[model samples]
Target: MKRHLTHLSKTILQNSSSKTLPLSRCLSTQEAIERRHHLFTLEKKRQVESVGRIEKIEVRYKGVPKDCTLVMNKDISSPYDCARHLSEWHADSNALALIDGAVHWDMHRPLSENCTLEFQSYSSTEPQAVNKAFWRTCSFLLGAVAARAFKEDVTVKLHSFPGPDIRSGSFIYDVELSLPAWSPAPRELITLSAELVRLCRRGAPLERLEVSEELALEMFVDNSHKAKQIPSIARTNGKVTLYRVEKHVDISKGPLVCHAAQVGRAAVAAVHRIIGSAAGEPEQLYRLQGVALPAGVMLNHFAFNILVERAKKLNPARSPFSPFGEDGVRNMAATA
Candidate 1:
């Protein structure tokens, strides 16, 4: 099977008559990275350009510092923009923005018409949405960490991640590593955590983009696994959501934390080398697990140690692939 796959790859490369369609574009992992970034940039520009005339919408801001009205551009301003008008602290510390006291809105997504705005911090009374947003951000950031942590020789293909499940004790990321059957040592986990810390130090603002299925598949052409998932992900509304940090873009239904600086005290707890005995599937994969506390959550080392131990156990949330089935990674009810 391995030899057949290698021969097929060579054949595809040698076939000079194949039309270089956008989705059919031949690419390396590095090229895939660049292509996705370029697509995001272009999409953003297109959205901005589509607004033929600038119109103002009143946003009744109802959060910290003071309540006020913001005359924002229609379909142009986002909750993050409103936060910027309030203070840098508001803009940076907020995890999710609630519009009209309901509807969790992404910090980077544009405001459509008019609505009241409320910001939710990690410590808010109803912290469930905010916590979920934080967990999703962590999962997304873990992908970035995994992509950058790898040596150039190894190909790092991010598959996808399950929705955020804080009660399950940790955020999880499922990735395809070139090392078919490899497990990391404790020192390696520490090293990966250090890489995550370094990324947080850089402080990239997570940006969100919603595109048509055609565009989403085009963006993920180099990643077979993500491309496969796009159709199912878009089945609900024929729209695909993507999040970007710096030059990296990955799929997620997101209302991620405003900035990376909000993440603190994170550790890669363990890597579980999992094997699938079922027919017609890759035999081996690794599930990366980690525990984190938001920047201001001051848990003592003793309590945090307990969380770390719990995280080492397999997170019981739904799996990224086949999230709602018998062969599923986990049952969805567990996440609730």
Candidate 2:
């Protein structure tokens, strides 16, 4: 699959007259997405190759179907792989992987060392971690849909998303548009929501990768806003973690749900404008908000409508533009 994508990328680049197309061009979105996905595939392959010698580790599994120890390949096997050794139900229902007793890890992320492993589903007794992961994934997918929803004339620059507040009843992504003034009609919002549902229905696995600061900068160089935020994000660990769903990639401090299909029902409830107060702030920011429920979660239409109404209101979550100095930037990057 990686080889096929690499070949396809080369074909795309060779077919184009210009090496790089401007953001305003219609073909730019497709070309940029292909290039980034190709890069991610290559980088991931290289990292896997670097882990030359394979070693075995004991993964003490906990949860249903009885607890047992499974021998997994270190730096090669992920929690999802462990699930595969169990049952299809384990793989399909689990949303996040909990390592030891505390750390929430991505299902696709490799197990570096031996530790107690447990899967957290949306229906877990204590669903806080899974809920947060689901919310964060929703916000990330919102950015993905918004980036491609408009025509070529409209240049969409994604700023950043606030931390997930599940109790607040909505997920969000703050975006900047080239348009001076515009409002989305109800139908338009519905269209965006439908696009999101279509993407999720495809059931793409949310792939996670942690890259060096330099590689991350190269990946997001097209977006000026993300470029500026990268340095602040890399300050803590000198690396940036990225999540990719299909062809779309974005920055986030994530332990996102295993697959897009986990977002059962969702709607693009509203897009509220955020006005900048300071001199260096953006001229205008549009907050794209959405409401979503987990797969198999049955809610009546009236109750769901109430949730949608609550999501339509401006979420009181902290503004991405709020001043936090260096510390604030770090905190924002950590959650965003």
RMSD of each: 6.3, 5.8
Minimal lDDT window, size 10, model 2: 1-10
Winner by lDDT: 2
Candidate 1, 1-336: lDDT as tens digits: 121011111212212222233553455455567678888889989989999899999999996677899999998899999999999888888888899877999887899888999999887998888888888888888887776566444666775677776778888877777776666766677778887776776788889888999999888887776776777777779998888988778888777888887888888887776555534334555678888888877999999999989999987654543424333532221121
TM-score of 1: 0.86
Off by over 4 Å in 1: 1-26, 277-280, 320-336
The 0-to-1 C-alpha lDDT of every candidate, in the order given, reads 0.75, 0.82
**Could you give me the TM-score of model 2 versus the true structure?**
0.90
Separately for all candidates shown, the number of backbone clashes (residues 3 or more apart, or on different chains) is: 0, 0
